[model samples]
Target: MNSNQTEQGIRTLGVDIGGSGVKAIVLDEQGLTITERSRVKTPQPATPEAVLNAIASLASEQGEFERVAVGFPGVVQYGITKTAVNLDPQWENFNLGDALSKLLAKPVKVANDADIQGLGAIKGQGVELVLTLGTGFGSALFIDGKLVPNLEMGHHPFRKGETYEEQLGRAALNKIGVQKWNNRLQRAIANLEHLFNYNTLYLGGGEAKNINFQLPESVVVIPNISGLLGGIKLWQN
Candidate 1:
């Protein structure tokens, strides 16, 4: 709430673009919440143009803001998307940062949604791994507050010819029932622990709310709002 922020002290309008919905929230320079979260259903077909329109509409409901931070459910590189994953193929290679900056008339930064989530969840020390289990599995790794680029760990092999995402995503949970899905998640966690040896692990995304078992001392479940909190940090150098 100072000169570094907007006239109203709003620093950034954070947008989280997921497979099912587009959500936005306003935060001040100090990372204090400045507005109620607003959400819009992701359009049918979920094409780039459709999602773009949805984001614009969602942003409009949040009043004024100086900049934007977008958490996209895809492989985003320097604001350019490299993979579609759960989104439309048209998103591949799309320069999303440039597109949103132009559309919203505000500076924009975009990154893998899970990576943004990690920014809000991590203590910025040791190796931290964040996994989001929703429409799809999303992951991000960080060490001492620095991101190690993007890791599409979800698509990596897990079981017999199926990927981790294929086994742990929301669809898998609904199709297999909660108990079986939880078993798959247990195995996934053990596998990830052995592989990454992370100091902490954070579970997030919409479906994370349904987790019914206790996690290890080092593992924690974070709310999806962490992704919006990350938008504030996204502006930091």
Candidate 2:
């Protein structure tokens, strides 16, 4: 592809990097998948270099693509990862976008995983919130389709001086039985509803299926694929 094609972003490789796995898919200009989604186990320790290698391996599996977009499970500011609570500590302050671009020989953009998932799931209407249940809790807020960016609500105190992630993350769920976890999630929903007053709440991530309680009418459970699908929006003007 030429510069114009690259600029237009004819084909985009979308990569979602999480604590447990890294998934990639090729999408056309319309943000529809054009290639089969591929996934690999996230390397143990998940250091920046190890994760980059995993992503690059997936990138090569997909056919020609003009550029790449990545959703990372942490705060990403201008492609620099500011946090990695679930991954190795070495990820902090790393320039993931530049690293991936150099590694893959393609332009790259990166954003917080939940933020990208919100980009894919939001309705672009009123205040919206997205909560991803996985190895850790991830959150994003949007108002009228404009992202608030890096809200990190998961790290905020929720109950008993514990952060939301500490109480709702996969580790927490496993520690507490399913019944207790479900109760906690219910309380969280009520609290979040009062706090954000969002018109919609989207629940996503691989663990979303574990939610056993009846969700409120305004809350919707989105497929895990939204994490990868939302990558296309990172390149949008």
lDDT of each: 0.89, 0.92
CA error at residue 51 for candidate 2, angstroms: 0.4
**Tens-digit per-residue lDDT, 77-150, candidate 1:** 98999986787889999999999999999999999999999988899889999999989999999988899778
Judged by lDDT, which candidate is best? 2
Give residue 169's lDDT in candidate 1 (0 to 100): 88
Estimated TM-score for each candidate: 0.95, 0.95
What number of clashing residue pairs does each candidate have, in the order they appear? 0, 0
- Which RMSD values do the candidates have, in order? 2.2, 3.3
List model 2 lDDT by residue over 1-237, tens digit each.
Answer: 343443454899999999999999988787888888999999997999999999888988987898999999999999999999999999999999899999999999999999999999999999999999999999999999999989988999999999999999999988997888889999999999999999999999988988998899999999999999998888874
